[model samples]
Target chain A: MSELISGSEILMQSLLKEGVDTIFGYPGGAITPVFDALYDFQDRFNYILTRHEQGATHAAQGYARVSGKPGICLVTSGPGATNAITGIGDAMMDSTPLIVIAGQVQAELLGTDAFQEIDLVGITQPISKWAYQIRRPEDITWAVARAFYIASTGRPGPVVLDFAKNAQIGKAEFYYKKCEFTRGYIPYPEISTKQIESAAQLINDAKKPLALVGQGVILGNAENELKSFLEKADIPAASTLLGLSAMPTNFRLNKGFLGMHGNVGPNMKTNECDVLIAIGMRFDDRVTGNLKTYAKQAKIIHLDIDPSELNKNVKVDAKVLGDAKVSLKLLTDAIQNAKHGEWIDSFKEHEEKEFEKVIKKEVFPENGPIKMGEVINLISEASNNEAILVTDVGQNQIMAARYFKYSKTRSIVTSGGLGTMGFGIPAAIGAKVAAPDRKVCLFVGDGGFQMTMQELGTILQEQIGVKIIILNNNYLGMVRQWQELFFRKRYSSSVMINPNFGAIADAYKIKNQEVKDRKDLKKAIDEMFSDDKPYMLIVETEKEGMVYPMTPAGDTVTHILLGDE
Target chain B: MENENMTLYTVSVFSENRVGLLNQISIIFTRRRLNIETLSVSPSALKGIHKFTITTFSDADTIEKVVKQIDKRVDIIKAFYNTDEDLVYQEIALYKIATDQLIKLGSIEEMIRTYNIRILEMNETCVVLEKTGHYEETQALFSELSQKVNVLQFIRSGRVAINKSKIERLSDMLANLNSRKPEGYVEDDEYAGY
Candidate 1:
């Protein structure tokens, strides 16, 4: 039986049909109909209101990343939709699944520039996976279903649906049917057995095989498959930044993170491997420094769901296009259990050298301003290495990526490809919403935190219990570091003169603490995470502290400087 | 990197008819800093679907990425890139010249025979000539006519292409989608409650 319902009701019904129980959004003029309908469905789903549209989007991203579901955000037209562009682009670059619904002016006023009207679909088309404007009330259910389907499908990214005001209030015969098939859109491509067999053969014969895992493994939920494949093949694995926490930190064959500021072992030993099996990770420029020489000596086998990423950057010997969970299991079944003792030992040797030359001094410095690494270590220990670590971009992010030890998949959420600052707090709110039972910790730099610190109001309103740790270096630390090393220490406009964060937190009526000494670090962290309410900790760190084991621009991965020259 | 001689690639996209899709597709080209040298949109063989033929000067790598991004659109059925050699393509040009000038030159018949042009219409003041060929061929004919007569107006339609392969890829894709169940749909029993 079909019931006649308003377009707003159709949207709410469609969302419920898709198994969505929560949405992060902000209400405004054009979206009144949706909000009115939401008022009736309040008992079915929870809507967490954020201060700004961007905050809602990031929070949705946080929820998506942690829950492995499409995060939903709703906002009104014009400024509200424009403000969300950054988050949409961030989700696109990071491959996060998000559905942003922006209300528009009446359909008649679409191009006439009516009050609170913008071409959101046109603006967001390039950045989003799919974008469309709903012109008819009859199409509401179908549009909502399509948005969810496109947003959460293969290589998930953000999708936008712009609903005209007339459609929202107009009546429609609503039969809530989830979108199953889009005419031209294929969610999953068929895997070729021949390609998998060739990749398996290469793995079986290679003496020194290294696995470069990316966030795709987590996105595909192939953690167990990846573990089994690594164990069976006896291959050493390394993670890209977003790929962190896919493998448990203490996994025997897991050789830490790999990139410009990554562990010395993975970056230095990338060229030494005979075969590089890239699983679910695109070779971004940051991950592969100087592509001309990146893993040049290795025979590469790339396994990914997206066909475009196969030879986009680094040329590969064999390509297996399919979901990671399926392809990895097939490769594991085709290969024999073997061990490369000496090859693994070589990576260990490099790790030890890095620890002796860089990690020891940077993480365990004794008599100076509290280092960023120490702060991350204290928080990691206080949370028992189990908290979901959300970080903003800059030195704070790189330091946290280096110091925090993750024991679970989907535990670390950061803006990876977009390198978006102001991402931590709102995303941490989303993570807390998605996984309320787990502890959520946000590590943000002072510069990045100030970009979206207004989200403190969001935390206060929602009572989200996220632990906020601000690494205050009194400057845009990452840019400052770059200037210091490469540009004769000109400093530029990186210096940020700021307000007292503790006072700001107090104004928000949330608990706050400050740590300038090493003695206060652990206790402050314990106190911050001790309460279920949101708390902010400001840690003063040395201004000139730089991320080491750096691969200068235009240089090979192997040519890395262990320390500041 | 700043080479002048970049190969031109023709990208064809098959999509369902929707407003603003052209704007969306054009934005991708704008973001990549690639200019669309020519573009044409018309109904495809499919009843409700449309085909967009776009030409841009870029390398194979960039064109491949553009096609992949275009394919990501929900309404887009499929997008493919082809080099000049892989497809047989043609463009039509319409030229309007002063009737008095053409008659005075007394070379309208000679020009029509030489360039394989057709007279679309004629009036007391002007005549319209249609030329169907490659872009360069059309341009060359227009130049010769202009040198001899007073050209009042000149317009060219974008390239329309047909792949050398016998089978239409879009037909195969649509058939494949038809053979399968719609995505994300649950059984009727499962949807009874919600």
Candidate 2:
């Protein structure tokens, strides 16, 4: 017997096939049919209703970013779909896997000036990795499958599917299947064997070769292979901002991050290394400093999944285009295992010396709330290396990078390229939903948390236990940090008026705490982790507290300035 | 200059309207800049779309780069550059000559025949003379005619030229992106099981 289904069923079926267990969304006129269809199959999936469409999109982004799975979200037509623009753009810039299904006015009303009708396909074309408008019921499954394929594969990004009202209602046979996209989409780059040979040779011959892993390693689930590769090659490794947690921070060869505010060992190693094998990193201008002098002593070997990245900026002595896991595994297998115990020991020696010289001196103002570093270190210690740390942009991100010794693969998820404010809480909510067994904590600043604080309602409604620790500096600390350093302390528009965050959490019916002193911070953190309810901790900090060892924008690795130096 | 030496010319062309107008005219210029030279609605071209024919005034390699940048702009229909010696070209203009100097010009009839100029419009106070030929020839006439008659209200409608040689346009980039099929191209089955 054959069964007939509506286009909405096809959309739902495609999400199920893609292993999308949760979706964050809002309901509206154009999307009523999707909601109705979702109502029937509610057991098959979970939909979290958000206060706004933007929250739904950000939440989806957060889930995708942390889980390395395709995040799914639904929204109504016109304004609801348009509201997801910023979040979708953020996901695009950061290369997060997201499948955004937006309802549209009926096929007949698509171009007409009908109520709630808009050209969603045209509007989302540039921002999304791919977008499709389904006018017929029969094409719904194919379009949605195509959306997932485009979104999850290659360089992951947001893909929007505009389901027309009539099409969602019209009947069609549902057949969920994987599809081959044979059009203006060539996602993977072909890595030449010669290129692989040269890259492997560089790894085999280097005296101090460091593997700078990025988010791509984690996204591809290649962390285990990378760890094995590092162990086999006996090469020390560092990470980029997005690359944190790809290798466990406590690993013997892990040298932490290697950019402007990266760890002392990694930053120093980048300056001294003879060969740097940058795997899955863009060598972003921020990471490379001045491109001309970036790694002048080294022969760079760049291995990335994207072709455009190869030789686009930093000249790579060898460019390999393949999956980081697959590529690293191959490179590991080809080379004979060798020992570089002395080189590894040298890294530890430098780390210890720098730790004594710079990190040992911690002079706080001797007042109010704890320093951001103290909050981060205390929380990192309390969480016991199992918590997923999601940070909003600014000083909070920098402090988290400095203090958190991320020991799990893909444990830290932040909006790296987009650096969107308020990305922390919703992302934390999504991350908690993705991995409920693992404790997810949000390290957000007072300025960044306010952007999407409304998602606290969703957290409450879902009763998902997430610890949101807000560093109440009363300013957009990163901008204020920059303004203080480079802009000569003009302090414009960075300051925030007193916000009753504890009261706001109470209003949402979530448990709230205020940590007023350094000792109180540790107490608040302990209580937050032990609590079964959604909790927010307001840690009051110095108004202009800056994260130190800051390399001014576009400065080299050696051009770092420690605070009060 | 050596026989092999060359430079590219970035030309701005303005012309009259017709269908397949650009393809017909630009077929003459080889190694053309790929975008029209900022087409604007000229008071000429009978108040039609002002088309630009942008090309580099250097060697073929320089013109290739110039063409690539210009071809990307959506507004431009066509772009190409050609050497002055290679193409049949023409520039046309209308000059309203003062009637008082008509006698000093010895007769509009004699001058029109001598310079291959056409008398498009005539009035009692002024005579409008039209010329169509190579851009240099038209300029020469415009200069020589001004000597005899006070060239009142002169308008150079601009040049429309093309290369006499045949050349194929550059290949499309979108086509290149579509034709690639690396390993693991097909993740799904050729056909789903029944």
User: TM-score of each candidate?
Assistant: 0.96, 0.77
* Top DockQ model: 1
Q: What is the DockQ of candidate 1?
A: 0.53
Cα lDDT tens digits, model 1, A1-565, are 4677999998998899999999999999999899999999999998999999999999999999999999999999999999999999999999999999999998989799888898898788888888888878988877787788788988999999898999999998878766767667777777888998999899989999999999999999999999999999899999999999999999998999998898888887789898999999999888899999999999999999887787888889999998999999888999999999998998878888888888888788888888898889878988889989999999999999999999989999999999999999999999999999989999999999999999999998888899899999999999998998899999999999989999999999889998888898878877887778899999899878888878877689988888845
- B1-194, model 2: which lDDT tens digit per residue? 21354553545443323222344334323324333332223323323334564433356654544443233221233344566666665656777887778766565676777888787777788878787775567778888877766788877654555556764322343235435744566634321111
Candidate 1, superposed: residue stretches over 4 Å from native: B1-5, B180-194
Task: Give per-residue lDDT, candidate 2, residue B92.
Answer: 68
Judged by DockQ cut-offs, the docking class of candidate 2 is incorrect
Lowest lDDT 10-residue stretch of candidate 2 chain A: A360-369
For every candidate, the chain B TM-score is 0.89, 0.56
DockQ, every prediction: 0.53, 0.08
